[model samples]
Every structure is written in C-alpha cells, then in structure tokens.
Target: MEQQNWSLATYCVAPHVAGTATLQGARLTDFGGLSVPIHTSSTYKVDSAEQGAVLASRKGWPELRKDGSTAKDEFFYSRWRNPTVAAVAAHLAALERAEGCLLFGTGMAAISTSVLSAVKAGDHIISQSSVYGGTFHLFSHYLRESFAVQVTFVNIEDLNTLERYIRPNTKVIYVESPSNPTLRLVNLEHIASIGKKHNILTIIDSTLATPINQQPLTLGIDVVVHSATKFLSGHSDLTAGAVLSNSQDFLKQVLFLQQTLGSTLSPFDAFLLARGLKTLHLRVSHQNNAALKIAHFLDTHPKVKVVHYPGLSSHKDFHLAQRQMSNGCGGLLSFELLGGREDGRKVIEHLQVINLAVSLGSVESLVEQAATMTHSQLNKEDLSEAGIDESLIRLSVGIENVDDLIEDLRQALEYV
Candidate 1:
C-alpha cells in the first residue's frame, strides 16, 4: 500500500484527536469551494464479510480497556455521525474553544436538551428573567409541566438575588447576556463564579453576542449555546443551533440526549453553518461597526425616547458590557419610539431596506416590535418587568453600508 501524506490543516484543526477513527484533516479545497457536498446516505457499506466482522468487533470492544488496545470503530450510520456534519462540528468546537460541540435542529432544541440532560425531577434551575420569550416559555411552562422541574427567574444584575433563589436541588444557572429584546448585559464572570461556588452548571445563550464577538467558555461558563440560525448562518438561509462544552463528560451527556431526542441537525444544514462561520470574523465586525453608528444616531434623535444598546453610555449595562465583550456591543439593539406602540409599528412599516421580521442576525437589516413579535406571548406586566415596552423596536443591524442603513432609519423615524 502506498503511504498517503495528508495536509497539516486537516490533522491540526480536525474535530477529533489525531489518529482517531474520525477524519483528522480538513481539505482546504472543500472550504475554498465554499460548498461542502452533503453526504445524504443513510448508511455506509462494508468492504467485505471480514470487514463487517472486524467492524462489529470494534463496536463491541471499548476504545479504552484492560486490553490496552487503542482503536475506534468506523462509521456505520448517518444518525450517529456524518463526515460533513462532523467536520463542521469540529470547526465550531474550535471557534467556541470547547472540547466538543453538537448541532441541533433549532436553538430551542439545544436549550431544551441541555436543560433536560443537566437537571432532573426535583432539580432546580436559576435563569435570567429577561430571556428570549421562547426560552422563558420553555422553562416556565414545558419544563415544569413535562419534567416536574423547578425554575426561578431572577434579575441577572443582582447576584444576591440569584444566590437567594438557589435551592439545595439547584443544578443549573443559565443567563443570557445582553438578553433578548432588552439589551441588558449580564456579568458572565459573576454568574460563573456563583455557579462554581454552588457546584452548579453555568450555561449562557451566546446568540446575541456571537463567538466572533464573545466567547463565554473563556469566562468560566460550563456550556455555551447559540441559535446558529441567527448569526452563525448569517444569511437567514438555514435553521440551526449548537451547544459547546469543555467538559468531556458533559459533552457526552449532551450527545446522548441529542441522540435519544433525535434533535440532530441535518448534514446539509451543518455544512451551511460551517460555510457561514468562515466569514463570521468579517461579517460580525461589519455589523458591530454599523450597529454602533445606528445606535448613536438613535440616541440623538428627538423622536427616540430611549435606546437600549450596550454601545451607548446612557445604557444601564454599557460599562459592564465594555468590561465583558470585546470588539463592540453587537449589532442588535432596541429603542423606544417617543409615541409608543403605534409609533414603533409606523417606523417598521416605513422602513424600505430593513425588513419587519421575527428572527435577527441576518445580513439584511431587520426591525421588529418586540412586545408584539418576539415577546408577544408574555403578559403586559412581564413585558414591563423585562423592560420590553410596547414602543420598543428591536433592530438587527446588518452588514449594509452605514450611510444607507442610517438613511433608512432616518426615513423610518420620520414616520414615528
């Protein structure tokens, strides 16, 4: 047999450790082409009867055992793994600086799986009150009803409040920094410290601040989750989610839930996510720049009663955001139009370039009335408590030219 020499990029950056059963190197050509051919096959074939016997034996044998043999089984099915999806997962793990990563069908799948795997009946969870409405509903309604789990929503700003809410069964503390629609920045270090003291798992929703802008694992968080559909996909072309964790045990548990729940992301979507990730450094930087400019513009506008952007000094969490996040305060921000809900709707209706949409972090600008769109399920009191007012409009600043985005906002605000 001729000895084949593989490129360094593949072995060095590949998902699994070197010499593992998995592919070790990423062919640069695959990325350069920017199109990873999806492996749509449900099953793989064995070369011969002898090869099948060997594979079965490998599967029956543990990779680590008293025999001291170091080997792994080859791929058998797409459900357990796929080459394309594994490659993308490896790349995402590298970006997240985690030991492993798992892709899911959507952000909610990732969140629900993590919570379900980490906590059990009688176990308690502490989370930020001002979270994405879907997440809030998941914790408050489904998790409670289905799993008999207990959750306490607390103010992220007050560490003491979180401490007060902790119970003997509390096993997970989740926080969403620069929380959805509200733009309230939670102190990652503070929450991580609290989790550590209580021997609790710390999970953060990093969708608002993509890994390009912030890495929660670096701040001592036990796990990081993302609505990859929002920013990692960066084009609104695909729906995906990812969960990253440095702990090998935790990763194994997450993977187990992923398999049992059948919430795995399709190989094609995984490939799209990987393609989007290659340009993340560029796209997110552009968005950050454009967002700051727009936020500043909104701050000075007479019709804008308040702007909830971490980039602005007027924001309550501006300094905290400056301390925690690098680059800039991300491209998503919310502002209250002077006239309230009607004014917010008018501005969104008048925008020519910015689309009125529900999801965020796409390349195209998007504006949404948070109270009526993303946070509509919550009652008026809950909305008020979360600082999500009826007049507040969430802006997902795109990578468009700053002047064009500004002019679009100018025309829209005129309607307000």
Candidate 2:
C-alpha cells in the first residue's frame, strides 16, 4: 500500500498508501480523488461459479504466503471482507510491520477472537493482572466459565516467575504493556523469548502504546491486537479493532474466526480508520511530549500523591520503559489524591479543558477515576489484586498546548 523504504515517521504523513487503495477498482476513475471510497456493497459480483468458489474458500492475503501457487484477492461477502476494510487492514499492517492484519467491529471482538484462535477447551493461559477490564472479564468469565479454559493472572514485573505459571497445556501468554490505569510496563522481548522457549503464543494488546510507541511484533511477540477507537482513531468518532501478526498461520486463524463470528468493521468506519492512521505518528508524538510535561506538573502538585506514568523518574518502570517504548511512553497517566476518591472526583469535575470521560487517546484531554470508571467491572477484592486505588485519576493528554493543559490541571488541583 505504501513505499517500503520510507521511515515510520515519514510513512505516517505520506499520502501515497491511502491514495493507491482508493484508486484501485474505482468506479469514478476520472474523479481524481485522494480519499478512500467507502465500498457500501454487501456482496461482490463474480464472473462465474468457478471464480466464486475460489474466492469464497481463500483465508488470508495472497502475497504474504511463501508457496508459489497464486491465491486470488477477491471478496464475495461483507462478512468475509470488504474492499474498504481491507484497505485499512493493509494500512495497519504496514504501520505495525506485520505480514497481515484483520479488522473487527470492536476491541473486545479482536481480543476474544485472537485468544480463542490460539487455544480451546482444556487449554491454559497466563495473563497480566493489570489489564483492561473487558479483557479481564473475558479471561475470567467468558473463557474460563464458558469453555473451562484455565487462566492464571500474574504480576508481569517479575519476569522470573512467568515460567512457573506455565503448564503442559499452556498455549498462550497474554499481556498488555503500559497497562491500563496503572501505567505498568512489560518486557515484550522477555515475554516473547519465554513464549518462544516454551512453544507458546504471545499476544499483546498494544492499544495504549500504538505502533508509533511500541511494535510488539517487532520485539518477537506472536500477535498484536489494538482498540483502534483510541489512538488510531484520534478523533473518537469511530469504533474498531485490529489483529496483526507476522505469522501468516496465526492471522489466518483470526481471519477465519472473524468471518465466522460476523464481527466485520463497517465500510464507513473503515474509511475513518484509514484516515486516522495517516496522522498517527504526528498525533501520538505531540500527545507524548505533552503528557510527559503534564506528568511532571502533576508529580509536583501537593494534592496529588503519586503519578503512574512510565515517563517520570519516580515511576518504578522508568528505565524499563525507556528500553521498551520508543517515541514516548504514551499519552495516558494515572495519579492518586491525598483525600482519596472525593478529591479525585472534584479534580475531574473542576477541569475545564479536559473532559470527564472514560476512553483515552484523543485530540482533547480526558480524566476519569479508574476505581469507578474503566475498571469498575472488578470487585473490591479484584481491584486490590489488580492494584487499582480508589483515588487513582487517569489522564489522557492530547495535542493541546502543554501550558494550557498544565494551567487547566493547576486550577483543577486548586479546586480540589
């Protein structure tokens, strides 16, 4: 979709990739448009029964395979794939430096499908304790309760202990870096090496880090999943998810499950996702710089007890984060208040420039208390196990002027 030689920073802004996809198979050949056209058609026209049969049976991208035989790149139904969605998938694959990519209607769909594709009933999984609430619920409730799959949640800080959780049936090592709310760091290379040594598949939800900050696949991880609703769609106007991998076999499995589940992304949302990716590096870089400044500001404030951003020296994982994440730690940070949940609530409500919202990684700043908001699905005991504090306030810094963001935070702290 794009020039392979260009650096990642230049590739993010270059318009060649999106333009090429839009030009191919375009009905308005003379329109000379630069944007990707939404293929609203539910099914594609096939020349004959023979052609239709061949297209319907194919599982993954043709060019990625090593075999000499050629596989046609044709879609028969929207449930299987759409041209607009495929375009975005291709774009994401390029950004993530993967052999193939698949899109889903939601982040949970991507996570669930990715995990399910790896193992079945009687299988075991080792996951990080501090993960997105939806993922925790999936492994704890849906996968374990429904399928009888075994799961062990462990603190990823101590890499030495990961091997102890593995069993003969263990098939997957699942983790999230710069973990939600807590801003904890996981050594991607260390986990990937462990998975490789034990013949286990490693999957990471790189939503917070994005590809600009961290590409787990490049670090030897098996699969990378994303909630494109956040940083990938920086405007917060669309909801989508992606699964990417250098392993064609793994991607093919995800593709089959996505087709079976009918969790395809819409053409319009796909267009938005493609557009969002063009400026990903730019948006993330600005957010990264601004967030580091804000983290410093919050660290010094008396009302704030602790800041949980990897960028800060006070953070236990600062040195580790420097080795794992490039560009910047991330736009998200969490901090505690001396007065507990009440002060956290007041700070969120008092902020003017920053919105009091649940989601993160957008053009505007957002603040939410993790105890009652994002991780509320977990009970009190679960919260304690996950190390989430009631006073923890999560902040998602945006592209706003660093001074303005600091000033708004200053006033909010004063009010609290």
Using TM-score, give the best candidate's number. Answer: 2
Candidate 2: stretches off by over 4 Å = 1-32, 59-73
Error of 2 at 2 (Å): 19
lDDT (Cα, tens digit) per residue for candidate 1, span 1-416: 99555432344344433122112222323344434557777777867877667655444322211111112234455666565666677667766667677788899999989888899898999888899999999998888999899988876566556788888999999899879988888888888888999999999999999876787999999999999999788999999888888887787778777877889889889777767776776788888888888999989999999888898888888888888887778889989977989988899999998889989999988889999899988999888767788999999988888899889889888875
Backbone collisions counted per model: 3, 0
lDDT of each: 0.79, 0.82
Local distance difference test, candidate 2: 0.82
Candidate 1 residue 257 Cα shift, in angstroms, is 1.2
Per residue, candidate 2 scores C-alpha lDDT tens digits across 154-191 of 97665557998899999999999989989998889989
TM-score of 1: 0.88
